[model samples]
Target: MKGPLFYSKILLFGEYGIIKDSKGLSIPYSFYNGALKNDGNASEAALNSNQSLKRFASYLKDIDQDLVRFDIDKLTDDVNAGMYFDSSIPQGYGVGSSGALVAAIYDQYAFDKITVLENLTREKLLKLKQIFSAMESFFHGKSSGLDPLNSYLSIPILINSKDNIEATGIPAQQSDGKGAVFLIDSGIIGETAPMVSLFMENMKQEGFRNMLKNQFIKHTDACVDDFLKGDIKSLFKNTKQLSKIVLNHFKPMIPQQFHELWKKGIDTNAYYLKLCGSGGGGYILGFTEDFEKAKKALSAHKLEVVYNF
Candidate 1:
């Protein structure tokens, strides 16, 4: 048995800033995705996945029914039959591996689920976000539900603030353009909870809060606006600023090895790197005005281009 696939997601802008009511833009990364499957094989991976699903099912059962309800019986029966998630999305890479699983489960078993084909109003979007938040909390200690929502919708989402979000479109990708957005593999895993905790702790300092509000969020908001408007010059300018600010303030969140490379980007102007998601390690997002030059500068690393403009 196999269920529908749910794709991974990338928060293109507003990583930590979104937590403080800053604008965010998330897009579906269709290159990696997952689905629920049952082959009746008790292989170690399948067994482990099945057991994990059992725990997740139990967690779902305990959620307040009035808040969100699932077809618990069906879920239980499937798990008993050796169901497991078959996925390609990398875990702890900040591309929403668990989120795709959560979205697939909700799509398959949630009662009165929001169908993707339906006309999604603001009210429906909010309701889905709330339900996904509660459901995904099982993975991350806290969640905004944006990951699951993006996977479920399979579309770009624009977050105006914490309370306002909507499906949105991005400027068309220029296949032959020199400027590009890419993901650089850090070749390490990052845990969301710890990184988030660090951010929260940093928030306690008045100076950190000020930088976040005045510089980080400001640059992030501008990047989002410029990207949406197809103002490449302004977008790159703000992206460079955002990248520098993240380097200075979010140092701990960054993996130690990339410190020099991150700084080199700003000093050399080949590429500006920023945290992809809760970055202790994993993929670092890169923006460049010239992909070829950036590629040459970072020859030792692997780069996956996600967008060109």
Candidate 2:
């Protein structure tokens, strides 16, 4: 049986800032997607996914009493039927592998959940986020629920400031343009828990907070603005700045062995690298107007373009 499709998501802007209610923007990336499938011969990944889902189902059942949106019966039945996630999205790569799974569960199993078709007011969106956060927490130790929300909604979402978000639009891609935005596989698996813990520890330092407020957040906020306004030139300009700031201040998050390669891009002006998600490894995003140049510069690593601007 085929269930609804859940596409992978890219947090184009706002990684840690969203935690503090800073402006954030996310767009659906269609290259990688997942869906519910009932396959008789479960692959290794499928079997592992099924086990994870069972644990999540149990967690949902236990928490259902205190919560209101989950549909326990349907989820339970599906678990019994050997339901598993069949996805192309890579795990531990910060592309929302778990989030896609969570979104599929909500779309296929939730009995009284908010419909993406409804008005989706801030109140409803916030409630959905709360329920999804609790549900997705089984995967990530903590979650804001934005990943599943975006996957389920399949629309450009803008966080107007914290506590407020709504669907929005991006400028249509130019098929013939030379510029592009894409993902570069770091060839290393990034663990979310450790990286998040590191960020939390850094937050305890006065200097860290200062950098976040003055540098990280400022460039991030600008990138979001330029992206939405369709100011391509300014967007890349600020993205390069953000990439540099992340390289300098968030060194712990980047894979230590890749430090030199990361610096090479910035110094050479071939491509600018930034964190794709939580960053202890995973997929680091790269931006370059000239795909050919970026490809040549990053020849040793694998790269995938999401859009050609």
Task: Evaluate all candidate structures by whole-model CA lDDT and list the values in order.
Answer: 0.94, 0.85
Q: Which candidate is the best by lDDT?
A: 1
| Model 2 lDDT at residue 220 | 89
Query: Model 2, range 1-309, lDDT digits (tens) per residue?
Result: 778889999998898878776788888888899998876647898888788888888887766555555777888787778888889988888888888988999888777778888998888887777777887888889998888988889898898776788889988888897888888787888888788888888999999898898888888889889988889889888988988898888898888877887898888878888888899878888888898999998788888888788
In candidate 2, stretches whose alpha carbon ends up further than 4 angstroms from where it belongs are 64-67
Best of the candidates, TM-score? 1
List model 1 lDDT by residue over 1-309, tens digit each: 889899999999999999999999999999999999998877887788899999999999999899888999999999998999988898999999988999999999988888999999988998999999999999998999999999999999999998899999999999999999999999999999999999999999999999999999999999999999999999989999998999999999899999999999999999999999899987899999999999999999999999998
Angstrom error of the Cα, residue 203, model 2: value is: 0.3
List clashing residue pairs in candidate 1: none
Model 1 ranges off by over 4 Å: none
TM-score of 2: 0.95
